[model samples]
Target: MADVQTGTRRAAGPRDTVWREPAGIGQTRRARPEVVRVASKAIRKSAAIVLLLALWEVLPRLEVFDPVFVPPLSENLAAWYDLLLSGQLLEHFQASLTRSLAGFGLAIVLAIPLGLLIGWYTPVADLLMPLLELFRNTSAVALLPVFILVLGLGETSKITFVLYACSWPILLNTVSGVKTVEPLLIKSARSMGLGPIRLFQKVILPAAVPTIFTGVRLAGAYSILVLLFAEMVGAKAGLGYLIQDSQSSFRITDMYAGIITISVLGLLFNLLLLTVERRFSTWRT
Candidate 1:
């Protein structure tokens, strides 16, 4: 009777607890909230963009500004389509891209090595700092006439102008990056018998790359600005030339189209640099 009672008690206790969940089930539930939080943050950032686009589409219809001066987004889009169809946009885009890339490329090639040297050697830094200050303080616009006179109103002049404008920030940032590398890292590498070249290649370069990229991004922006200015000053075929011509002819729609194109190009350039930076600097992230 007692055995029978004990068996009954055991059977009724909890019925095996309905297969209780394994450990960490609560953690899995917690992770879901984290994911939702991240998604919400992304949505919040994008909200402003959506609002701006809506305002862009609605402002002209409300007639807050003259439809002629502030054409509806649809009219601007139509102007873009017309230019695309005529192939004028493509030609000018190619010209502007070529000049910008050439100048920006030259700046990168020249600035980085020179900057590394200046940052690596005290004497080099002392010698170049004064000269760097002198030229960097001078405006690129002020030198436009000099470049035009010396290099002539040609592709070379435009490329040179972009090079001059982009070099300063890139060089300066690279120097700062190199100088700011943690001394501990360098000492550790030296203790491991790493030579100067290997030390720089393995430790200094990697450490400084984030700062260097900051300058590169700045140079990219300067590249576009300088290219547009250079193209406007003298160019038979380019986006700047198209904008100038359209404005002079009172083709406001087409001018806006050109401005939009340049803005889009600048955005793409920055996005490209950002993507590159993220790919190379994953550890920092």
Candidate 2:
């Protein structure tokens, strides 16, 4: 018994000497300083953007660039304030918002169903791909005249321009999503005797959702770009018109404000989409 105990102790000795720290009770404790360091890094990164604005503000005043083309941040801010106070800025913004939203809504409605159809059906996708590719390649700006001819130079033309530009991305992404459904899942589904509708709902649609959303996001981006271009071509209101009108009138400061507005709108839309993506992608997390 003494020999056995010694042997057992000897066998355990190396393991005991082996350098393993004690296992954590549950989650490993994150160091406070490390956490602070991470947060500080994030702050620094965020502040870099502010630093850029500061440079933009300072550099022009120093005449590092032309004041006419590169106006000071202060001038731009003052311009924005003036416009905001006058309420003309809001009028332009509301008009742009109304047009963009209307066009985007229509594009979403069309793209979603068409995308699903093309994606879920290989033969349909094959048939439609060429035409879609053709149109996707076509410069949306080039169609401005055609839209004007058909719908007049009114809001109708502007809306049509946005819709035409936005539709392609959604349609293409949808096709990608649908066509990408896992074969194994489909096989398993078929074996289990799930009907076409049930298989699509339970498996295909869920799998394709991320792709569908990707398209929607792309469509949102495209709509903004197209709307800006269309408004530049023909419109008396909206942010695009604001930029053109301001620039043409040599109100460089107001032009900067309009550009800033467009940037803010795009950022908000992108943020909204990202939030939606995060909300829906629980399984991924």
Candidate 3:
């Protein structure tokens, strides 16, 4: 009987360990509670933040870095407070916001239609994409000198430069969005006998909404980035100019404060875009 059993076991291919082991499949199977999973993730994230703060505190306290070169959080806040009290900080903040919004608006106006055109027609894409890529590759800073010469060191020049830099993202995203609409969707619309305009209205635009929004978000980021340089070059007011001036005068606190303000503003703008994206992309889910 033992020999027969051994032979029968040998005839069978390898037994599944998971099925054979007494405590294997059931006990080894994952059964993490939702609470534990959430708690673990939260713990990891909190630990990461705490680690960063600890490093920030320790690095400056040790003076391993030059105090002048690296202003600690406290010193930077003090400088920010001083600027806040003087009202200079607010003035610059407003100027930067104004320029960024203006430039971003211009980019939206120009990029959306162009993107749609390119996405809809292969010929348009073939002709224009090369030129777009060429211009996009060229540094915005390289064009700054020409803009300054043509538009002067005024609000116009600064905002327009921002628009020029920010437009590429919006345009590219829009084109991609339109081009990437599901072929089935287009075919379905055609089978329904939808006209060109109706098809674009019903299928293309809705599908492209997410992509268009992506472009807008990217443009928003570039708006601030380009505005920073614009403000730095020759602006009497703006956060970029404020930072430049502060650094020039060795007011490290003010410089740090300006940077903080810039970061906060940029974050807010990004949040605004994200909110819009979520609201519009609800259908995707």
RMSD for each of the candidates: 12.6, 10.0, 10.6
TM-score of each: 0.84, 0.86, 0.82
Candidate 2's C-alpha runs over 4 A off are 1-28, 31-35
How displaced is residue 279 in candidate 2, in Å? 1.6
Q: Residues 1-285, candidate 1: write the lDDT tens digits.
A: 123222223232555533324436644655566677668877897999888767777988899878888888888889999999999999999999999999999999999999999999999999989998999999999999999999999999999999999998899999999999999999999999999999999999999999998899999999998889888888898899989888889999899999999999999999999888777776663
lDDT of 3: 0.85
What is candidate 2's CA lDDT for residue 188? Answer: 99
Candidates 2 and 3, the one with greater lDDT: 3
Of models 1 and 2, which has the larger lDDT?
A: 1
lDDT of each: 0.88, 0.84, 0.85
Q: Taking the tens digit of each residue's C-alpha lDDT, what string does model 2 give over 1-285?
A: 123222222232645553323434212443355578668777887898999899999999999998779999989989999999999899999999888889999998988899898888878878988998888899988888999999999998899888888888888887888888889989999999999999999998888888788788888887887899888888889999999999999999999999998999998998898779767664542
Report the C-alpha lDDT of model 3 over 32-121, residue by residue, as the tens digit: 554686687778879987786566556877997677777677778888888889998889989999989988998899889999999998
TM-score of 1: 0.84
